[model samples]
Target: MHIKNKLSVAIILALTLGLAGCQSAYYKTMESFGYHKRDILVSNVEKARESQEEASEQFKSALDKFSALTGFHGGDLEDTYERLNDEYESSEAAAADVRKRIDAVAEVGNDLFDEWKTELSQYTSSKLRNDSRVKLSKTKSKFKKMLSAMRKAEKKIAPVLNVFHDQVLYLKHNLNAQAIASLKSELSNLETDIGKLIAEMQRSIDEANAFIKDLKKQ
Candidate 1:
């Protein structure tokens, strides 16, 4: 690798290690307050679900703004562009939060599963050990499913954001009735994409709820 590339890799590794250390310290602090990794994982999953839910609404709102532009008749085109821009910005923020929350859930969940697996050997009774091992396996399986769903939804956000970004940029350059007409042609495809995105988000939210319920039960 080139010198600059090696330095970039070193910086990335250092940041990764720093974040991991901070997360470990935070977990320890929470444990002191009687909150285990399992509890934190559940909380993170819930937050992730909430973020998706909010993102779903924000995306829908952005779509609505985009759709309204199709019927633009004798109004200030600049004002309409501003509204769409605001919605796009809000959608971007919501998508970012969803990604952040999902990462948080994955972090705590991996830690919880790792600790659970390690502690299984400490059990004096073979029966209890086997039982815990089975439960851990089931929980891990469910978590993987939920995380997959979250990731599927997360993947959908970017394309929709890209489309919004393009439209917003196009409007910024050409804020005129003719530009609105051009955008009108793309509305159908955007609607279809947003529809799919919202559906996937709902599926992820449902999976998160199911995982949280199962975790609390166990």
Candidate 2:
């Protein structure tokens, strides 16, 4: 197969074989193949950031659709439902991708820090060892904060998704102007929740960007 396809297959297999559960063996294998923990950590963080960006857009699109639906005088309700449902699915997938990437980043980060600490113990020079230890501490602190922000953002997703799910299902049952009017009544609360979700997502995205920049500079 093509090189890109080969790489895609490899990644799918890696994830399927329990990237987290077998992380020790997985890391060893990747390292033997010349991919180190640092590379994985950076890549995963980028993936998480991308996912967050997509999720943000998908959510905003869904909100826009809802707003438009409220003002909608007439339209094919089935078509609108399908569009919103598609947006919800896309958002759900994006959220899942972000979580996966964050977990991968965390796993590699833990391994990298453990190895750094172990190597520090091996260093005989007090000044050099102390400096390395200090840098490691700072990196770990930043990573912890980033992970916390990411998890907080992730937590916000489920509630928003639940709201979307309810709206979608309700629409499926009552796909008419009357249903639209009923949902219009709910638009305010929905918008409020989505606004909160978007804010959390933006915060996490900013943290991810900073974290990625720091890692690159290291």
Residues 1-218, candidate 1, lDDT per residue (tens digit)?
A: 99677656654554475367776666665565556788778888989999999999999999998998888887788888899899999999999999999998988889899999999999999999999999999999999999999999999999999999999999999988778887899999999999999999999999999999999998
Residue-level lDDT for 175 in candidate 2: 88
Candidate number achieving the greatest lDDT relative to the actual structure: 1
Q: Which ten residues in a row have the lowest lDDT in candidate 2?
A: 11-20
lDDT of 1 at 121: 90
* TM-score of model 1 vs. true structure: 0.90
Model 2 misplaced regions, further than 4 Å: 1-20
Residues 63-181 of candidate 2: C-alpha lDDT, one tens digit per residue: 89878888877768899899888878887887788788778778778989999889998888999999999999999999999989988988998888887888888998998877787
For each candidate in turn, the TM-score is: 0.90, 0.87
Which runs of model 1 end up more than 4 angstroms from their true locations? 1-21
**Cα displacement (Å) at residue 122, model 2:** 1.6
**Model 2: how far is 61 from its true place, Å?**
1.0
Candidate 2, residue 201: Cα displacement in angstroms equals 1.7
lDDT comparing candidate 1 with the true structure = 0.89
